[model samples]
Target: MIKIGTIELDGRAVLAPMAGVTDRAYREICAGFGASYVVSEMVSSKALQFNDKKTGFLMDLGEAERPAGIQLFGDDPAVMAQAAKKAMAYRPDAIDINMGCPVPKVAGNGSGSALMKTPSLCGEIVAAVKEAVPVPVTVKIRKGWDKTSVNAVEIAKICEAAGADAIAVHGRTRDQMYEPPADWEIIRQVKEAVTIPVMGNGDVYTVQDAVRLLNETGCDLVMIGRGALGNPWIFQQINAYLTDSCRILPSPGLYERMSVMVKHIQRLCAYKDERHGMREARKHVGWYLKGMRGAAEFRRRAGTLETMDDLALLVRDIVAANSVAEEAGR
Candidate 1:
């Protein structure tokens, strides 16, 4: 177990907050599969301050999922503090400041990773949020604004000094975006430099990668982002691999996969209207079929689906066809 302030997480594997992903349905799924913690998608402090309906909807954590963190992004200290306070109403286990998003619109406004360039301002934001909330306050950061400024260690120290309970370091410079390799060495350095629990993220695609990150970086936790796109089983795989060095089990057969996908769609429908749910399910369906045989055709069908019934029928067909093909191969 790893302790972040007074809260104890069951394991070291966490789900990284992704903008349109990591909603309540996904968080509950990951928690069921053994993820230690899950962070909500980044919400704008400005939007929260304005009482945006969409932003308020994003903060909603269904009764099934608890102990999740709500992450906020903004450049203004007062606004950030107020946002953190507002997020507290949702009863998140913690509040996280997003200092690592490399998106142009976000960083261009001096929020997200732009905070890395102003260490003192970042420190002030952390202090303000920490003072405003009763729960643990954490900060997520990148290596630096770019390769030339690589100052995560320095910024991490400032956050710790400002009373952050923990720090999560994504080991890629803002310029790298989601590129080649994530510099685990820099993650290692940050872990070594900080007193609070450090969670290492980037390029962790498999259970072996998770093990390697822990062994190499000595970080208290590993946060999985792109790797968990269609693979919620990753949490179970990592957990099993850590406890027992067996080659982790493969994904379930086509029928089982379809069952999970169907459940995801139903959950989405329950959370939003049928039209919005079907629309959102398109991206998830694409991710679910990724790399599988006939996935291109399946993706095309899934994208054009107009109703829940259409989606369910399409998934059933995909499963049956795939199972028949597998039998023929055998």
Candidate 2:
């Protein structure tokens, strides 16, 4: 068991926080699928300092999603420290600092991956948050600001020295956002450099990928991002493979897939209310329909979803079409 301070992470696979995607509802859904740990969507330090009410929802961790972390992004040490203190009110098991996000809104503001450029400030922010919060402090950092820099080890060591409990290394530099072939070697380097636990992240899309990453880098955990987007079952598959003699679980059946998708969207609606949740469900529904027979057309209808009834209708249509496709194949 890996302990982020006092919190014991029971599994090696974790859900990486996505800005607009990893909400409270989604975190609970992923946790139900055996993700050892999950993180909140990125919260702004400045927003916390100014007492933004909307952020309250972002930091909400349900009992089902135990041992979750609330991720905060900002470069200012003092502000981040205050944000950590505030996030503690939501009772996160740990406070994770977001130093890995490559989005321009964050990086352009001298936050997120931009913090990787200033190793000293990164250290200061970790030390400050560690001081302000009662829980453990962790950082997520990229390989570097650009291809020319490549300084993850330097920053990892600094954060460790400054009281960071753990570090997650995304293999690409900020310059290569979401590019193929994430440099897992950098993750290996940071794991070797730091005594604290290192999580290897980037390009892990399947059970084999997760196992290979763990076997290859020897990191403490595998943090999965986009790969887990519409595929929470990846966690279950990874768990089975790791614990069950490398068994590969087949993908969910069509009925089970539709059932889970509807349940996920229903929870999203329950959490965010029907109007906002339905809008958010568009992309998620699209993701769920991936690889289905006649999926392109279904996804087009998913985009136009306006209410629970609309979603129910779309799901019924998907199930009917796929059922016939399966029957014919047999």
Which candidate has the top score in lDDT? 2
* TM-score (all chains, Cα) for each model: 0.97, 0.99
Off by over 4 Å in 1: 245-247
After best superposition, candidate 1 residue 230: deviation in angstroms? Answer: 0.8
Residue pairs with clashing backbones, model 2: none
- Global lDDT of each candidate: 0.90, 0.92
Enumerate clash totals for all models, in the order shown: 0, 0
Q: Please provide, for model 2 over 1-330, each residue's C-alpha lDDT reduced to its tens digit, 9 standing for 90 to 100.
A: 888878888889999989999998888888999999999999999998877888888898899988799999998999999999989999999999999899999999999999998999999999999999899998999999998999999999999999999999999999999976899999999999989999999999999899999989999999999998889999999999988888999999888888888889999999899999999999999997888899999999999999999998998888888889889999
Best by TM-score: 2
Q: Each candidate: RMSD to true structure? A: 1.2, 0.8
Q: Write the per-residue lDDT of candidate 1 for residues 140-221, one digit (tens) a residue.
A: 9999999899999999999999999999999999999999699999999999998899999999989889999999999999
